[model samples]
Target: MFIQSQPADPAIHDKALRIANETLFIIRCLMREEEWGDYLREAYIIARRILEEKP
Candidate 1:
């Protein structure tokens, strides 16, 4: 992960970390409702699709 400073291209490290944290939060919320498996499956699918679309 990269963090950009002035005079450098914007880095996506912070954004990536935020997304990871959000995913963990979602998993925790889902687990409380006994929905962790479903949430994980959906998250995996969405992540794969996103990766496939990345340049």
Candidate 2:
């Protein structure tokens, strides 16, 4: 038998989206740093993707 998945919780989903936005903001600030700029750029892309996705 196939298992069914529960519907997405709005609270949790909102919280996750908020966190992703915050992460993207922080990453954006750090991306300007000379040493870690490259790595932070990649991280920013990932966070941005998470923020853009729907539940």
Candidate 3:
């Protein structure tokens, strides 16, 4: 017999969407600005990876 898969949790989904939306503005800013500090650069990289892997 095969097991069924579960859907994503509503709260978790909402949180993830919110995080993705929030990052868009900053990410766009990062695109225009030439000066990115170490922390911001790291955050941009992580955010890009997350967005790329989305279904």
Clashes of each: 0, 0, 0
Give the whole-model CA lDDT for all candidates, comma-separated. Answer: 0.49, 0.51, 0.50
lDDT of 1 by residue, 17-54 (tens): 44555796855853665675566556544544453343
Poorest lDDT segment (10 consecutive residues) of candidate 3: 1-10
Model 2 lDDT per residue over 1-55, tens place: 1112433356644655565566666666655557454554455445445644676
Q: How close is candidate 3 to the true structure, as a TM-score?
A: 0.40
Index of the highest-TM-score prediction: 1
* Clash list (residue pairs), candidate 2: none
By summed lDDT, the worst window of 10 consecutive residues in model 1 runs over 1-10
Better of 1 and 3 by lDDT: 3
